[model samples]
Target: MLQSSDYDPLTAAMRPPPGETQEQREEREAAEAEALEVSNRIDAEIKASKQAMKRQKKPIRVLVLGQSMSGKTTTIKNFQMIYAQKSWAEERSSWHIVICFNLVRNVNTIADTLNEETTDSILTGRRSSLTEWHRSVLFRLSPLRRIENDLKAFLGAGSSESVEIHHPNRPNTSDGLRDSPSAQQISPPEDAKRPQEFCIWSSSGWKSILNQVKTRSAQGKESQVPRMVRAVLNSCKDDIHLLWNDPVVQSLLRAKHGRLEETPGFFLNDVDRILSTDYTPGDEDIVRARLRTTGVQEYRFTLDKGTGTSRDWVMYDVATAWIPYFPDITALIFLAPVSSFNERLMENPRINRLEDTFVLWKTVCSSKILANVQLILFMNKTDILRRKLEHGYQVKDHIPEFGGNKNEFSSVLEWFRRVFRKLFTDNNSSLNRKFIAHFTNVIDTKATQHTLQAGKFSTSRSESMALRYGCFKVQAAILRNDIEEAGLM
Candidate 1:
């Protein structure tokens, strides 16, 4: 018997039969050689896999929080355009259909407004503002409504439901907002009616939907739908223009709905260019294109920072309900459309949009789980805010707390900045946290790119400082242990 310490288990297991012939011995040797080669290959693969894992950096997780149409998606697009140029270029042409849909939907919205006004006047037996000429224009432009439906269908499954806005449960007043005196003034609309707003469920994969539309548009049999849509829009172009420009339709749109010009994805002003046969969306048009997100969306990109180092970044465009789930996020980009001071959420018409943003911001700041995460507040849509101020829309009219401050853009912007900063200081419990705010018009590509670059530099500096601080703590602990070991304490 072999001693336990000296046992050769591998050799014993590989021992051949006792009556084996020379040819059988040779076969056994060959089989053993093949097995050894296979084992070596697997070991090499495992070693390579481990090396690759070691080379890969952990993904930086970012969460983008904002209410609907707050430029969250547009901001992500900017990141893609800057860092993932190849993919952005590939998807650029696919936005043509979406841009067309936006234009068509705006026209249809105008038509619907006119119909509602006309019907209400008839029911009330009031003198109608709509003339026979207006009636004729509406009749001629009816094809756009069908085109909108077809475009929605081509967009994919959840397209029908995209017309309905789902109102989330009103923000809990207990989430830091209840303490504010202004919170009492902000209430939901008495009539909580669901309005028709175009949105896609995040689960449906909107990029894939756009790609499918592009693919089908190229195929012969499936190409007719897009062609038909183009043909209808082109034919109705003149009538669409007439109706949109008509004083009666304009008055009705203004009275029933707010300025369509102020609306997200308002392309009516570019109907002539958009309806042209060779129209391709410019960067601005694509950025401004409105598609409301109904659920959480995540995006990933590999960024090379030019120092022979690259990092993977994963960004989550999340709904309010999903905020708490990402406690370990590297950063939170909160977008508040300061321009929406006078407007209400399409989902919940009762609460002022800006006020809603305030509540959301406070809630985010007060979350203990997110206390350590870097917070970046984007006071987005400053362009729209400037326009509103220029148009004489008073900030005091919507936000009483704005007081008698000058309604000028600079004053209003400063006031918003101060308010946001106060909220941040009040709610955040982290002693090491920093407050970063940027007034951004994310749709303006050049301006947004500059801001993003500055943001990246600031974040890098902060991270470097943190790393040095951690190293200092580690060195201090080691020095203390050395002193103790030396009996010098």
Candidate 2:
């Protein structure tokens, strides 16, 4: 009984025209079919997009924490090399300038040290091991100084700042290592100061610095700075070899400055290969290269689990200013250099490096914000510790509390592990949390890759368990409410 004009306007418009010709009807039908197909395709696309959004999980967040030079950045590099191989390969060539800069810095540091020794010998009227021949060798190596400056300029302001130690708030005296007698004893002499080393900040546009190299290479107009650096290094390679091999230089480094060979980024041994005309960094070289990160660095990866599943992960390499912003992280990878028992932080020579790490660890464990966060302790630099013990560096001499323990690798490592575990157990309030530790030398890519893979698996499992536990709590609450409503409780 409804009039045709009263029907829905949209439906009425779609009806066939009155008294339409056969050709016109056929054309209209075809057009209507085409419109319907387009509409269906768009609907399919929208559905697929919604499904993809559901499948895409929230990114897994991780935070890497350590004192300066504790291999935090190196650990990140290992992750990229393993999980993000394509991007890692793309960036490998850009590390050439950084490696070259490290070599030049080493040469310059040695030259300055030798010059200081000579000047001291002259001032004190003491006989020196360095002769005129050594002086000439130093003179011949002076071009490296200019090259170093050029590389530093190219790397930007991050490489120009002095590396400083960041002191965070400590726990109360009842729970801290700051007031311990051993900590007191670890302080260096008032006059002692560490030499300045090359450092870069995360904000210094490292990617841009690297990309400049890549972009230039792609454009076939390589920068003169790189060409000049190679030229200088190639020219001075033999003198570098001679200076590093000189008995006097070795003795000075051992007796005064600690062994340069043991330090990160010691490329003097590989001078021949590194300084060759056609040198590109290998995986090991890129891993071994040292450029101290002064601020926070973030890395993202789309990791495939090989089970037709993939996950997105974001890892942060952080310095001291990490607490407030990153309390929501899924896991914290704390790196403590177990070998730093005898050394001091480069920024603050007074505080023992090991003590600093202990204080930092204590602070982290005691944080209320990170209570639910999974903690993974990496007692790193064990390889260096083993080498030190083999070289007869006594732990007892530096750490008085290490009294009477065997100076072998296992005993020393166990002793250090016990200390770190104790700190965690004593400071952490969460009883459900388990202590996880790994001895890592992050410079060894193969070994570290295996450890990191295991770490990734463990972290994922922990996250899954946490999610399940949360669900169980929510379900239990719901059941309790239902029972109360039904008067069953």
Candidate 3:
């Protein structure tokens, strides 16, 4: 070992002269500080290298793909509600306007459906006729046309001027009144701007309409609107139950072959509750609100627990077109609406909606982009499917291959499962990729939460014996099923 004084001669040689000036000492001290800083920077570089390795292991990036109205966006919303809750309250405030518009649109539909009614006792009571009430409501609501149009434009309908109307009620409660950031209302432009979205503010015409309502209410003015018309909006649960159950409306719906009965969110059902000046959509209403997915949108939230310790969750809500080609995908969540079996595609009425969904699934499954990625199929809208069963809908009538032997939920579900499995088995390059399936209501947050907890890692985790065991079982079942059907098992 070196002695403590071994460096004394070298130290003396480096020291300043006996009468060294203050400037010389200052320069020495500065040099020491510079050396120390260099040492610290070297330590920092070592630390940064380690952190870079961790960041290179990026969090799971899930892709949510489906045809329009396949619940992709709703799934993203649920993810936010479950995870990034600090912001959901703020975002939900913007939906108050949307809920109001839904109510008005439903009432308008009913009125249009029954405009020819003249002698129906249910509609023409001594109080007032339903047609007359519809006319009065439409007359009073003429001012809202601009507001509705603007709201639609903002929701990605088309590039149009956003109309902002005076919000009559600014409730102090925490429900949202904020608008989506995608679009905003602006004053008339002198020069053309990038046409994207529209917004509406408190214009004079809108304010005047609310003022008339307040004045009339203050004076207890006699109203031409029927008490039943008021009931259609006034009694939240009971009134709409009555309206839909009305014998006259039922007769008219059957005569026209309209699908009002088969659908949910009859906004008429929640009219009065949603229309009341105090109306603010609750969490459930926001979940249930029917907004069509228009374009490729993304939602991100930090999961408390999922896939891995990264806690970061990113899911893309994509429609049929303009989907990004992401090479590093962790999972692909493909959705098909099971209840849409008997419906027609909104965009192409000539095609069956279920058939459209099958085409979409096949296309997505066959894509080379997702060849190695895991597959998760969600047979969404179980609640609607159950209701359709209770309503005595025969699946074979709509899907003839389903065979008339069985018309229940289980049989129909199995048929769909087999259809998807056959698609996968037929196209598999080596049958190495696994196809996982779930019956999802999607709207039920608890059910979806459970699915996330169970299948959370199904997409991101590396192959393991246990997971491969599950995959083998899935494949074995499919093989056994095929053999049984072929009478060769």
Best candidate according to TM-score: 1
Each candidate structure's count of clashing pairs: 1, 0, 11
TM-score of 2: 0.80
Candidate 2: count of backbone clashes, pairs at least 3 residues apart or interchain: 0
Give a tens-digit lDDT track for model 1, residues 277-315: 678888778777876646678787665432234666677
Local accuracy of candidate 3 as per-residue lDDT tens digits, 423-457: 76666543567665666663554423343334323
Enumerate residue pairs that collide in model 2: none
Model 1, residue 290: C-alpha shift (Å): 2.2
Error of 1 at 150 (Å): 1.7
Q: Superposing all C-alpha atoms, what RMSD in Å does each candidate have to the true structure? A: 9.0, 9.4, 14.9
Q: What is the Å distance of residue 60 in model 1 from its true position?
A: 2.1
lDDT of each: 0.68, 0.69, 0.52
TM-score against native, each model: 0.81, 0.80, 0.63
Model 2's alpha-carbon lDDT is 0.69
Q: Which candidate is the best by lDDT?
A: 2
Model 1 per-residue lDDT at 353? 71
